[model samples]
Target: MGSDDQGNNDVGRSGFTRRGFIQIMGTGAVSASLAGAAIAARSKPVPPEKVMDAENTVKISLHVNGAQHAVLVESRWTLLYVLREAFGMTGTKEGCSRGECGACTVLIDGIPRYACMTLAVEAEGRRITTLEGLMSGEQLGPVQNAFLEEDAYQCGYCTPGQIMAVEGLLRKNPTPSLDEIRIGVSGNLCRCGAYTHIFRAAQKAADLKKR
Candidate 1:
C-alpha cells in the first residue's frame, strides 16, 4: 500500500479505538468507585452513642383506677396495649382496633375513650377507669348489680364497654332516658342482641343512684 494511504487508514482506526477505549475505561472506573463506596459504607459500624440512644427506653406513669403504674413502653404503643400487656388488665377488649368498636372502652377523666385508639402517652397524668376498677372491695359497684338484675349481657364480651358507657352517661345526665341510654351505648356492639337488657341496666343504675 502507498505510504499516504497507510497513514490515513492508521489515523482512522486510531480515532475509533481511542474513543471506544476511553469510554470503556471511564465506565469501568465509575463502576469500581461506586462498588468501593458501597463496600465502605457497609463496613462502617454504627456509632456506639447512636446505638445506645436508639436502644434507650422511656418510662410512662399511668394513673389507672386511682393507682399509679410505671410502665416501660414504646412511644407508639396504644393505651389498650399498655393496659392489657404491660399491666395485665385485660378487661379492655380489642375489637375493631381502629376505634370503631367500643369493646376497648375506658374512662378518661370520666369520659369514655377508645383505649385501643388512645395513645398511652396521651393518657399521662389522666385518671383512667377500666372494667377491672369497677368493684368496691368485695362488693360490685351499683352498675354491676344493675347489669345482673337486668340481665344486661348475653355474650358478655361487650358487657364491660356497655357498663362503662352507662356509667359515663349517668355521670353526665344523672338520669338518662331510655333513648338517651341507647344512644350512649350505641358505640358498643353486642352481636348477641342484648341491647334491650343493656338499656334497662342503665335505667336500673340511675334508679339506684337516686335512692
Candidate 2:
C-alpha cells in the first residue's frame, strides 16, 4: 500500500485513475448538455409558417385562348415564362424583356400587350391569346393566312407579335384603314424590314376576318 508502483496500479474508487476520471467527467458533461438540448427541442417544437422566397410557387389559373389552365408559377415569373415554360406556348418569343421590343407580344382580353412586360400573376384572370391560338384546329386564322399570302414575315422572328397585334387591332376595328393598320402594329418591330408587306398583310387580314 505504501509502494509507488502499488499506488499507481491500484484499482481506485469507481475503478478509474485520476486522469481517466477527469476524462469520463468531461465526456459525461458533453453528453448531458446534448441530452438537455434534445429534450428542450422535443418539449417545444417549431410551428409552420409561410416563407416568401424565389423557390415559392403560387397556384394560378390562366384562360389562354379558348382553354383553361391551372398551373403553379413562381412569384417573380414573367408572363413570357408562364406562356413558354409553364403552358408550352413558345410562340410568344422573348425579345427585349424590358418591353422595348414587341417580339413577346400577345393578346390579353383582346388587347395587345407585351408578354415580357406583363407578370404571370397579372395575367392569371385574363384571356391570353398567343400565336398558337390563332389556329383553329390546324386551320390558320385569317391573320396568319394573310401574312402567308403577302409574305409579311421575312426571318419570321417578329411574325408572331406582328400577327397578334394585327389580330387585336382587327378585333377592335374589323375594317382598319392602311394608316390604322400601320398605327396598330407600330408597337411591334420587324427587324427584317418587312413593314411594307406586313401592312399589306394586315389589310388583307381585316378583309378576310370581316367575311
Candidate 3:
C-alpha cells in the first residue's frame, strides 16, 4: 500500500506491492472517468415535450352541420382523421388513402373536397359536412333516400361522398336531368358499374325537390 499527495490509500485487499499501487491508481482513474461521464450525461438538457407533442397536437376549428368545434389535433393528421378520430364522424370512407379515390370526400361549405388530402388546419373555420350530418333525426335527407330507393350503391364504398355531391348538385340545379346527373357524379367513380343507378338516384333527388 501507498499514500498519494491526496492522502488517499492506493492499495487493494491483496498484499500492497509496487505493482499493487499501480493497479490501485489505474482502477481509481477508470472509476473517475466513468463518474465524470455519468455526470455529463445527467446534466445534458432533455428535449422539449412540445417537440414530441408536435406529432400529437395542432389547433383546429370547424363548423360542422351548423355546429362549431375547436380541437387540438396531431400535426400529421388529415381532415378525415380529425372528423373520424376526434369528432366520431366516420361516414367518410378511407379508400385508396393516397387520395386517388373520392371515397373520403366531404363538403366544405357546399363544395366537395377530398378529406384525405385536406389538413385538419385547412378545414378551420369552414363548414364541413359528413354523411352522418346529411340526415335529420329520423328522416333521411332527400339525397340519402334517393340513393336508398334507387339502389345507387353496390358495395357502397363511395356512397357518402356520392350522396354529398348529389346534395351539392341539387342545391345548384334543382332539376338536373339524367345527363346532368351523369355529369354531376363524374367525379365519383363506382367500381361496381352502378353509375346508372347512382345517376338515377340524383335525378330522383331532383324530382323530390320539385315536390
Candidate 4:
C-alpha cells in the first residue's frame, strides 16, 4: 500500500488514529468498570449493626396524658400507631397518615404535632397528650366543651385533632384573633367543611379557658 494510503488507514475521517481510538475506548471501558465497581460497593446492603433496622424493637417509656407506660416499639413505628395500638388511645385519629391531614394531631410537650409524622422513639421522654387526654374522668375539657357547644365537628373524625390544636393554641395564646385561630388549626383538615364552626369553636375555647 502507498504511504499516504497507509497514513490514511492509521487516521480515520474523524481525525482520530485507530490506535488512539482504541486507547480511548479501552480507557473508557476501564473507567466504566471502575465506576460500576464503586457503585456496586456503595450499593451493598448496610450491615444490620451499622444501620438501624426497621424491624428492630426498642423499649421506651412514654408519658401520655397523666400516666406513664413502657412499651416495645419498632424503629419505624409512628406515634400514631403506638398511641392507637399500644395504649388503645384511638382518639388520635389517623387521617392521611402522611402528616398532611391533622387527624393524628397530638400535643408533644404541649405543642401541637402530627403523630403520624412523629416517630414513637422520638416521644420516649416527651409528654404526649391525645384526644382522650383532654378530659377529666368523663368531663370534657374546656376546649372539648367549646367544640361540642359550637358544633365544631361534623363527622367527628378530625375533631380530636382540632381540639388538640386549639388546646395548644390557647396554651400559647389565650386570646388569639380570628386570623390567628385560622393559622393555628390550619394543619387540621375537616373534610366536613366545618371551618366556620371550627373557627367559632376556637374563639369559644379561648373564652372557656379563661373560666
Candidate 5:
C-alpha cells in the first residue's frame, strides 16, 4: 500500500503531477473570472445625469460693438463664428481657426484676444470690439486711417487683426517706441511681408491719436 501511494504522487511523463495540474487549472479559472468581472464593470452604462452637455445649445447675451445682442449659440461655437455668422460681421477674417494666426483677433474689454480661440459663451457680459466696430458713422477710426495712409497691408488679409492689435497697444501706451510697437503687434502675422509698413502705421496711429 505504501509503494502504490508513492507511485500515485510521482510526476507523470508530462512532468506535472495530478495535484500540480489541478492547481494550475484552478488558478487559470480564477484569473478568467477576474478578467470577466473587469470587462463587465467597464461595460456598465453611465447614468444620464453624469453625461456632459457637449451638444446642447445655450442662449447668451453678448455685448459687442457697443450694442447688446441676444443670440442662441452652441457651447462650442467660437466668438469668430458668432461674429461672422450670427451678427453678419465678416470683417473679422478667419485665417487659422487655431489662435496662432491672429487673423481672427478681437478686443475683449479693450484687450486684444484671438476670437477663434474664444468661445461665444465666454464673451457674454464682456465688451467686444471687432474690425467692423472701428468705424464712427462710415468714417474709419484713427488706427484704420493710419493703416490706410501708410499702406500697411499688402494682401489686407491680416490688416484687421494688425489694426486691432495696434488699437489695443495705443490704448495702453499712447506713445510706444519702435521696439514697443514691434512687441505690441507681435502676435499678428502679415504673410505679405508688410512688417515695415505695419510698424510705420502703428507709429502714425500714435501721432494721430495725440492730435
Candidate 6:
C-alpha cells in the first residue's frame, strides 16, 4: 500500500510495537507495583516481636499438642528449635530454614505455618501442633495412618511437614478436591516427586475421616 501503511505495519496493529514493548511493560510494572502497595496496605502487620531480632532471652509458656510447656528461649530462636531441641519433638524436619521449603511446617492455631520462620517468643500463648502431636496416646491419628497406608513418603525427610500440612488442609477443608489438594500441598516440596501418592494419602485421609 502507501509508505505510511508500511511503517504502521512494521510497528504493530495495536498497542506498542516490538521495540516499544519494553517501554509498555515498564509502565505496566509501575501500575502493578501501585496495586501491590494498595493490597499490602490493607493486610495486617506481622507481630513486631516477630520482626525484631531475637538477641535477648525470654521465658514463655506454650500450649503444644494439649501439653503445656514453661521454657526459656532466645528471642532469635525459631519455634522449630524449641520444638525439636528443648521439647525434643523431632518429627518436624528442617529443610530450608528460610520458609521456602515446607519441611519445617507446623500447625499454629489450626493454621499451617513454617516453624523456621516463626519466632519462639511470638508463639507464646498459642497452640502449636507438631507432627508428634498427631498421636493419640499410643495410636497414630487418622491423617498419619492414612499417610502410612497410602505410602506418601520416600526418603521421609519431608514426610513430617507434608503430613502436618495435609492435616491442616483436611481440618479446614475436610473433603478437598484433587486440585485443592495439589494447591494445599504446593508449599511443601517433595524432592522425590511423590506428589501423586501424597495426594492419594490426603484423599484417603479425608475418606478415613468420613468413616
Q: How many pairs collide in each candidate, listed in order?
A: 0, 0, 1, 0, 0, 2
Measured by TM-score, how close is model 2 to the native structure?
0.74
Enumerate residue pairs that collide in model 5.
Answer: none
Tens digit per residue, CA lDDT, model 5, 65-109: 666667888878999999889877777899989888888989987
The local lDDT score (0 to 100) that residue 20 gets in candidate 5 is: 22
lDDT of 3 by residue, 147-202 (tens): 76777777777888788888878878898887787777777778878888988888
RMSD of each: 31.6, 30.9, 30.0, 28.3, 31.0, 22.7
- What TM-score quantifies how close candidate 5 is to the native fold? 0.74
Instruction: State which candidate has the highest lDDT.
Output: 5
lDDT of each: 0.70, 0.73, 0.67, 0.74, 0.75, 0.74
Per-residue CA lDDT of model 4 for 1-211, tens digit only, reads 1133234433321222222112212222234334334433653323223234679877776667745667889988999999888777767888998889898989987889999999888776566777776765435688877876776766778888999999999999999999999999999998889999999999988988787
Model 6 CA lDDT for position 115: 97
**Model 3 misplaced regions, further than 4 Å:** 1-56
Q: What is the TM-score of each candidate against the true structure?
A: 0.72, 0.74, 0.71, 0.74, 0.74, 0.74
Report the Cα lDDT for residue 36, model 5. Answer: 34
Error of 4 at 117 (Å): 0.4
Query: What are the runs in model 5 whose C-alpha is more than 4 Å off?
Result: 1-52
Against the correct fold, how does model 4 do in TM-score?
A: 0.74
- Which 10-residue window of candidate 6 scores lowest in summed lDDT? 12-21
lDDT of 1 by residue, 1-211 (tens): 1133224333321121112212212222234334334433644323222111333456776667656667776767889999888877776788889878798899987789899888787777566888766654434567766876776776677778888888888889998888899899989988989888888889989987687
lDDT of 2 by residue, 1-211 (tens): 0123134443322122222112212222234334334433553333233333686887776666655667888868888998888766677898888887798989976789999888787775466778876765435688877877777876788888999999999999998899999899999888889999999999988888878
Q: Candidate 5, 88: how far from true, in Å? A: 0.7
